[model samples]
Every structure is written in structure tokens, then in C-alpha cells.
Target: MSDIKVISTENAPAAIGPYVQGKIVNGLLFASGQIPLVPATGAMVEGGIAEQARQALSNVKALVEAAGSDLSKVIKTTCFLKDINDFAAFNAVYAEFFNAPAPARSCVGGIDLPKGALCEIEVIAAV
Candidate 1:
């Protein structure tokens, strides 16, 4: 059987739906898509794309760390954006969290996100 473990952390926003924060299997951490909801308040953050992106990435970072990994160890990321025009702005914020040798990524636009968030981010990392 596959050895899969669920990853959870109070530092990040709890899952809004019926899902865990992340999963670890075979030394890899697969994190769920994180929106800009404040962990403590469970409220969507208010701001432009940059601010929202920062919060989303921060949530991702928290979950990654909770899984015994860090942003530097991320292998891939899938991002969802409500508006394509915010790509540049989102990238600017995303760059702040991920350093050089950044993980492979895919960002899609025009997707309706939960809680009307500007963006959401999910990642995979080495644990």
C-alpha cells in the first residue's frame, strides 16, 4: 500500500472544503491550492493582486513547512488567477517567496476562485 500522510497546520488557513491541507507520500509533499484567506480569521484578504498573491503564497509556505519542507525545496506549482491582466503583478509577489532555481510552475487565468479571491496557489515539494 502507498504510505500517504495528511499534512495540516494551524498557521495556514484551514481548508474551506472537504479536503486536507496537503499530503506527503514517498518523500514528496503535495499541497492543496491556497487562497488569500487569513488563517486566524478565515476571511479573504482585501487588496490588489499583489497583496492577495502574497497571502496565498504565505499559506502555501506554511503548509509546506508543516510537511517538513520549505519553499526552496518546492518542485512545482500550479497557480490560478481570476484575471489574466494581473499576471505581472502576481509574478512580482510570487518572486518574493520563491528564490532562484525556482520550481517549475503553471499559471492559468480567468478561473473563478473560491471566496472571490484574486488568486490561488498550490505546490509540490521535496519533504
Candidate 2:
């Protein structure tokens, strides 16, 4: 088995559970799902779905970067929304974070997210 390195950073919200923020193994980084909690305050960002989506994506970016990778290096992502109806708004916000040839993505709705966040995002990237 390859050596695994745990990834964490103060620039991103601390993990609220037992899991670390992410892990790197064999040149790949796998980030945990990031909710809309503000890293500095540990408080859920307040606003609508778009605002919440932005914060969640921001948190994902921070964690990815902490693992020595950037958003452009992300290969895949999984997003969850409390309400599927907010998909369009969430997509618009998400588009701001990634460029052309964006990472393969899967967004699902009607799901319960941690800390009552409107959205959550996790990423896989090349380290």
C-alpha cells in the first residue's frame, strides 16, 4: 500500500467529524465534503442557495490547495444540495470556481447536508 498523508489547514473549516479534511496517496488527493461553514468562524454562511454554494465551493478549494493541488487540477467532484430546485443557482455559482474542461462532476439534490447547510462539495485532484 502507498503511504497516505493527511491534509488539513486553518484556511478551511475544521472537520466536524472524525475524518480529516483530506488525504493524499499515490499523487492523488481526496477531499472530504465541505459545507458552507466559514473557516474562521466555524459558522454556517447565511444566505440563499447561491451564497451557500459559493462558500461550500470555496471551502473545497481551500482543502484542495492545502493538499498541494488547485481547483484546476481537480479531476472529479460530488456535490449535494438540500433542495434540487436550487440546482441552477448552484451551478451558476459553481461555474465561477472552475474553468473550461471543468472536472467531471455529479450534483445531487434533496439531500440533507451537515450543519444544515444549503450545499456541500467534495473534490478529487492530482497532487
Candidate 3:
């Protein structure tokens, strides 16, 4: 295998640690877990899971677009939440983006998240 190409975009939150926003390998785009952190100010979005999920997905949207793909091209997504009880609220927001024939997905509850954010998302998409 060749080196993994790092993917990044101003439209998405900048990598806060030692990770790239996403990577391309073997014609697939693998995105890092995107929290609701706003790239422009490096701050978490206001509100709870719904707003947080929205920002994170919107950020994912930007990353996919930057990689010459879009949400329709997404094949799978993994979601993380600080509280499982917020699942319903999160789904409400997520549904607006995925629409019908949604991509394969899985969500898990966690103890904590970066910047005290409520949710995070990562995606794999065709390229």
C-alpha cells in the first residue's frame, strides 16, 4: 500500500490533535470523527445534541465536498454521543441530512467528548 493521503478543508474543523480530518486510500474517503467545534473560531456550537449534531454533520458535508464527494456518496457513518438519552434528539437532526435510503450507521454512548461537546461523527464515502 502507498502512503495515506491526508484530507483537510477550511469548511471543516481543523484537526486539534495529531490527526488529519480525513484520508483517502484505495479510492475511499475516510473521515475523522468530527465534533461540533466550529472551524472558524475553534469553539463548540451552542445548544445541545441537536445543534451539536447539526454542526458536526455540516462539517462532514464540507469535508466530503472538499474531497469531491457529497453526503449522497457516503456509504457509512459512525456517531458518538456523551449521553445515550439524547439519541432521539440526535436522530431528529441527523434525519434532516441523510433523508431516505440512509447510509449504514452506528452510534454509541461515551463518557466524555472533546471540548465538552455532545456529539461527534465520522464518515466513509465513495471517491
Error of 2 at 82 (Å): 0.5
Q: Better model by lDDT, 1 or 3? A: 1
Candidate 1: 10-residue stretch with minimal lDDT: 43-52
lDDT of candidate 1 over 1-127, digit per residue (tens): 7899999999899988999999999999999999999999999888889889999999999999999888999999999999999999999999999999999999999989998999999999999
* Order by TM-score, highest first: 1, 2, 3
TM agreement with the true structure for every prediction: 0.98, 0.98, 0.95
lDDT of each: 0.94, 0.92, 0.91
Q: List the residue pairs that clash in candidate 3.
A: none
Model 1 CA deviation exceeding 4 Å by range: none
- RMSD (Å) per prediction: 0.6, 0.7, 1.1
Residue 6 error for model 3, in Å?
A: 1.7
Q: Rank the candidates by lDDT, best first.
A: 1, 2, 3
Considering lDDT, which of the candidate structures 1 and 2 is the better prediction for this target?
Answer: 1
lDDT for 13 in candidate 1 is: 97
lDDT per residue (tens digit) for residues 27-119 in model 2: 999999999999999999989999898888989998988888899999999999999999899999999999999999998899888878889
